[model samples]
Target: MTYDIAIVGAGIAGASLAAAIGARARVLLIEGEDAPGYHATGRSAAFWSETYGGPDIQPLTTASRAALQAGGFLQPLGSLHIGRPRDAAAIDAFLAEFADTPVRLERVDPAAIVPGLRPEWTLGVSEPSCAYIDVATLHAAHLATARRAGAVLATRAPFHAATRAADRWTIETGAGIFQARVLVDAGGAWGDVVARAAGVDPIGIRAYRRTVVQLRTDPPAPAGLPHVAHIAGRFYFKPEPGGRLWLSPHDEAPTDPCDAAPEEIDVATAIDRFEHVVDWRAAAVERRWAGLRSFAPDRRPVYGFDARVPGFFWCAGQGGFGIQTAPAAASLAASLLLGEDVAVPVDPARYAPGRFGR
Candidate 1:
């Protein structure tokens, strides 16, 4: 059967987009893995921080907050952007950057909130709007919503090739061949690859590996410990329910698309960085994993059709902010795809695929 739109990737980007499109169009959600979200979406250390993807991404994140909260996917956890004494300039810059934005930012004593904080790490910027996202639930809900709206999900359907003829696209995948009026490259890390296979120009989407380690600390992390991140982007850590701590070195090493794994050096670096921030001792390394975060050349999400490729849409390059901004991003992409009015207040032209030029 010919679908109105075929989305190549059943991760957050594809699933959320499909959910947003709803019954407005006949949709096909394609997944290369045996199940959807087996890649980046599944591996994300999910958190909703308005300042995560920088100022450009904040609008989408802010716009998505209501929808996410309404769906009961957000749990208030707050966030603290901590800095060392020498990072006073960075602290000031952070505040000045978001002064005009709705995101509430305030200065605070790091040690007061984050116990055992090193003396030198005196500066702190509190973002009270930060929260933990129920990623698995959110992803599952999107897929369910889309399915309920009559979208078909084809698992293990690795897109191999596609040829545009007339007004339809003949898409070949591992599952089988299908036809769709519009083909969306929501393949996450493999987005560019899908675009290339479809004879469309790639948007230079590059994937980077981010490492996270779950550690059992000597003093048992406090449940109230907010998500703590270094101003220098050296590391970030937050408390887990069982007195464990989730930490990341904030490393963005460029790597080819694949099942990413944490490097020993990266793990060690995270522990070393964590130690420097607080007096807490990491007693055991419980777990370590890595995920790929793809980004466009300008580090902004691409959410519109390719200007040069007919019936081809670009819905990738969301980086690490995809989960937090999914609702708004999906709304924007759906508007563009279905020729509807922009659902969110953010300017669609900013994230348009045309920004990269033909």
Candidate 2:
């Protein structure tokens, strides 16, 4: 059976695209893992903050809010961007930059911040629109939608190779042979690798490792401690159930495609940064996990088809913003694939793979 589309990497990117593509075409969603989203999507920071990805990506994030809430994928949890006196100028610039955007930032007085925050954190802003994302729920929903729409989802099916001939692609995988007219490289960290395997030129996409550590705090982590993060990107922390605090040092060290594991230094650095931000002492690291956030050289997401490779679509390089932007990102990608107007308001050209000289 020949499918209209064969998408690699059944993470959020692929699943969401499959869902968006709907019953319009015969779609094949493939994942090498035993289950989908074993990488970035499953290990996401799992928050929807309009300020998370800067101005270029805010449009996608904002466009996804309605669908996220309507689908029961959002939990009310405000975000806090705390700044030190030294960060005054940076904080001011951030507020000014998003003044007119959908993200609403209210200046926070230092005295009102969480009790344990250090005195140096004198300036802060509260973006009340921010919310915790129910990532697993959302990912499952997208996969379910795709399945209900007749998209074939094959897991534990590692892609072996692909060849294009006579206007169709013959794909070899662990499961079996499949033929598709078009292929979507939603391969996450291995996006470039997938492209190369398909006889398509690589687009220079790279993956960076992000580490998250769950800490057992001395004072017992507060349940209502808004998603607090340093404006300058030094660190971020949020409350987890079980009185633990999820913390990251904001590390973005470049890494090759692999099942990522947290480094000792990364974990230590996170705890140290957390100590500096608040007076609460970390008693022990309850657990730690790492995921790779892939990106193009310019850091914006890369979408659209390869200009040089016919029937090849690119839906990679979403970085940490993958799950949060899935709704709009998938809509935009599906539109490009099907030759329709993008449901999202942003211009698609900026994210096109051709920008890399394809």
Candidate 3:
């Protein structure tokens, strides 16, 4: 059956976009794996911070807050950007960077916010609006919403090739062949691959591996502990129930798109960095995983139609801010996809795929 639009990935990007446009068009949510969100969406560390992904991305994150809160997907969990005396300039730059924005940031004592913070790590910036996102629930809700809106979901459908003829696309995938008037490349790390196979010029979307590890610390993590991150982008950690801690080195190692695995070095680096921040010791690593974060050359998400390919849309290059910004990003993409008025506050031109030349 021919669909009005066929989204090539059923992760958050595709699922959310499908939900946004499904009511207005015939939509198909294609998943490469047996289950949707088997990649980055499933491995997200699940936090929404307005300052994440830099100022260029803050607009989308801020715009999405209301929706996320209304859907009950957000729970109060503030964040603390901590730093050492030597990082004063970085701290000031961080503050100065978002000074013009509506995000609330205030100076605080690092030790007061994060218990056991080392004496050398003295400065802190508190972001009260930061919160934990119920990622699983959010993803499921989008999929359910799409289904209710008459969107079809095809699992195990890894897109292979596509050919455009008479302004329609014939798409080849693992599951089968399908036809759509518009084909969307929301394949996350494989977004460029999808574009290439669809006979469109790739937009230099590169994937990087990020690692996270759960640790049982020597001292049980405090329930009230805020999400702690280094100003220098060295590490970040947040408390989990049962006295566990979720930590990452903030490493963004460039790698090819694949099933990402936590490297031993990265896991070790996370623990090593954690020790310097606080007095607590890592008793054992309970779990470890990694996921890919794809980014355009400019590190901003790419949306809208491809400049060189008619009826081809891009909904990729979201990096780590995809989940937090999903609501606005999806709305913007939907508006572009359906020829509707843009509802999101952010300017769509900033994320337009045409920003990259063919």
- What TM-score does structure 1 among the candidates reach? 0.99
Report every candidate's CA lDDT.
0.94, 0.91, 0.94
What TM-score goes with each of the models? 0.99, 0.98, 0.99
List, residue by residue over 122-201, the lDDT tens digit for candidate 1.
Answer: 89999999999999999999999999999999998989999999999999999999999999999999999999999998
Better of 1 and 2 by TM-score: 1
Task: Give the per-residue lDDT of model 2 (tens digit) for 1-358.
Answer: 9999999999999999999999999999989999999999989988899999788789999999999999989998898898888898989999998988878889987548587778878888998988999999999999999999999999889998899999999999899899999999999999999999999999888989999988889999876778998999999988889888889999999989999999999999998888887888899898899999998888889889889989999999998998989999999999999999888999999899888885
RMSD per model, one decimal: 0.7, 1.0, 0.7
When summed lDDT is taken over every stretch of 10 residues in candidate 3, the lowest stretch is 109-118
What lDDT tens digits, residue by residue, belong to model 3 across residues 1-358? 7899999999999999999886899998888899999999999999999999999999999999999999999999999999988999999999999999999999998787777878999899999999999999999999999999999999988889999999899999899999999999999999999999999999999999999999999888988998889999999998788989999999999999999999999999999999988899899999999999999999999999988889999999999999999999999999999998999888989999888776
RMSD of 2: 1.0
224 in model 1: Cα distance from truth in Å? 0.8
Clashing pairs in 3: none
- Model 3 sits at a Cα RMSD from the real structure of 0.7
